[model samples]
Target chain A: MADGPEEIGRLIGLMARLPGMGPRSARRAVLHLVKKRSQVLLPLAEAMKAVGESVRPCVACGNLATSDLCPICANPKRATGTLCVVADVADLWAMERSQAFQGRYHVLGGLLSALDAIGPDELGIPKLVARVTEEELTEIILALPATIDGQTTAHYIADALPELNVTSLAQGVPIGGELDFLDDGTISAALRARARV
Target chain B: MADGPEEIGRLIGLMARLPGMGPRSARRAVLHLVKKRSQVLLPLAEAMKAVGESVRPCVACGNLATSDLCPICANPKRATGTLCVVADVADLWAMERSQAFQGRYHVLGGLLSALDAIGPDELGIPKLVARVTEEELTEIILALPATIDGQTTAHYIADALPELNVTSLAQGVPIGGELDFLDDGTISAALRARARV
Candidate 1:
């Protein structure tokens, strides 16, 4: 019954899958959502719907956008000669939220995981190289995770972009730490980075 | 640029307007959502779509459900001679997440507020009275908040149910403190109640 975990249990299960939310927090969150149907639940439902319909990956750079191209990729004023490469859109969003980095982004989708069999193709290194040339790119900034795979992906992309100026976000970004967790200020500091690899 | 907080800034603006979220937390949360688009955002978008299309209020209790009666109201066994009356769906969800209160719930939608012009009709007190008599209820537990309006609503309902049994959740449910914020254990402790009004 919906009265028991059997019925509403699905809610808890899905919530548990969320980051920072475990089985217990998931249960609590589901309860809270249902209880505040009008004031909280209904509005939340609407917000969810809007995001679902409108949210999509920016085709040009792999950043999130309501359109085919993310705002940065579409905006002509943004610095086209520079591209900040990141492992995921979350990292892209984190940098965006800082109100720094007037340049464009190229979301790598994921890192080069040898164990998972992910390599240059998986991380879109070839496309990145093409973009460096096509966009007349002067610099390519690596904002990848500080993991071994992340570092490998960065080197692979750097090696591919020999003609372009390449740099990495400072050692300031924690090892294996997702760029999402850093405060806006830290992201800005990392972007004013020096050359690497 | 995909590098500004414009959309996320707007999203954070809307999010900060939610019941509990503030500007700082909204900023952090938006960053999280944007970064985890594939893992969190895509799934969240799908979940929101499903919930939006499927979710509606139970005609009887105002609780969220994909069906007409809600799982709680439809069950014949749950039509047991007990009704747990709560001020809002959040309280109802709080009760549900505890895995307690097997009988059924009556979501009053809101407490009695004379100054705000809310009264018995506004809170569906008449339907509650009808449910008690029609279901041949043995007990009506007032799980309402203890705020002035919440207490006022409780007293009115209790008075209305003078001929039937009436009780209130015990000490664990604090005065004026919302049940949504209370953990499941506390809600369970209160529901394992002893006294009756």
Candidate 2:
């Protein structure tokens, strides 16, 4: 395809690199931006620039922040004596979206993956341990995925902080999930973790 | 949802307004950008700023360009005595991707719509007619969609320039399209425009 212009082509190329965006979708997005230059493109550019300049990783947790500590960590009311450990910022955001967790979060950046050469040091597990020891925390919630690597990381963190009450998110049928459509593993997990009426 | 930070929240909001993006996808994309700040966010921000500051609609056609005249209009070799008119810049880009058209393009910005109160003047149909007369163009190809509004706009343009040879993109079975899966309208069009072997 004929690259429209140097800058436009470059912009499309960069946009295509974004997660869930391909060349065709990137082209559509750029077209939308160009058409609504004053409304969408300018504001998005300004917002991105502001975030690029101001946003940083929270010093305590790995959550994104404009300051040394993220908003959750900075809020005084969030000190619930609990820290939710997640595999990444996405998971942390997911947890926040559900409005379930009341405490701060520690984003491991990723789970333990032997194939990817990711270890405890790479995921800031030592920092996590340090925080648990330094703070008056009583509970460490492992909100990681149910994948093998996620389980391994949870086990590792649990072993490292035996003193603190470490618990993981339960695996079972989702809130609106139907029993028939559920996979075998989910069904088994639900049966195993069945609660009393 | 708890707005993460002022800048981050603003970024997500702006991203959510883009084509093919919603609140959830915007949040996910923003999180991805924040996590890979150096790799994706920073560069994307810079590229967006560059495009926002430099990109503009070409004066002759509505195609995006860094200058008053677009690259196609500026190129002497592109003066193929034929002009292809499309509804938007995206259609022009799609035509370019096909690499079949060697002439110039005239983006109508949008089609004529009574419901939306859009007319010939709004779509710069007069400007298109003037360009055809002044630029020594022999043919005008209406490369609009096959929808009702698209056909109405095409008919309007054809009537406006009766002195010139006017045509539109053919409607039939798409390349690599299957007969069994084709819709009724498409099958009828293909049968009507059937070629002799």
Best by DockQ: 2
TM-score of chain A of each: 0.81, 0.95
lDDT of 2: 0.89
Give the range where candidate 1 chain B is weakest over 10 consecutive residues by summed lDDT: B1-10
TM-score of each: 0.63, 0.95
Model 1 misses residue A41 by how many Å? Answer: 7.1
Model 2 over residues A1-197: C-alpha lDDT tens digits?
A: 36577888888988888778889889899888888888988888888878888988889887888889887888898866999999987788789989988898998999899999999999989999998879979999999999899999999999999888999999999989999899998899889999998
Candidate 1 residue lDDT tens string, B1-197: 33333555456565565434567666556656766666665565456445545666788877767788887888787757788998876678778777778888888888889798998998899999998888889999889885688778888998998998898876577778798999886688788864586
Summarize candidate 2's per-residue lDDT along B3-73 as a digit string, tens digits: 57888888989998888888888888898888777888888878877888998889999888889999898
Model 1 Cα shift for residue A123 (angstroms): 1.1
State the TM-score of the second chain for every model. Answer: 0.77, 0.96
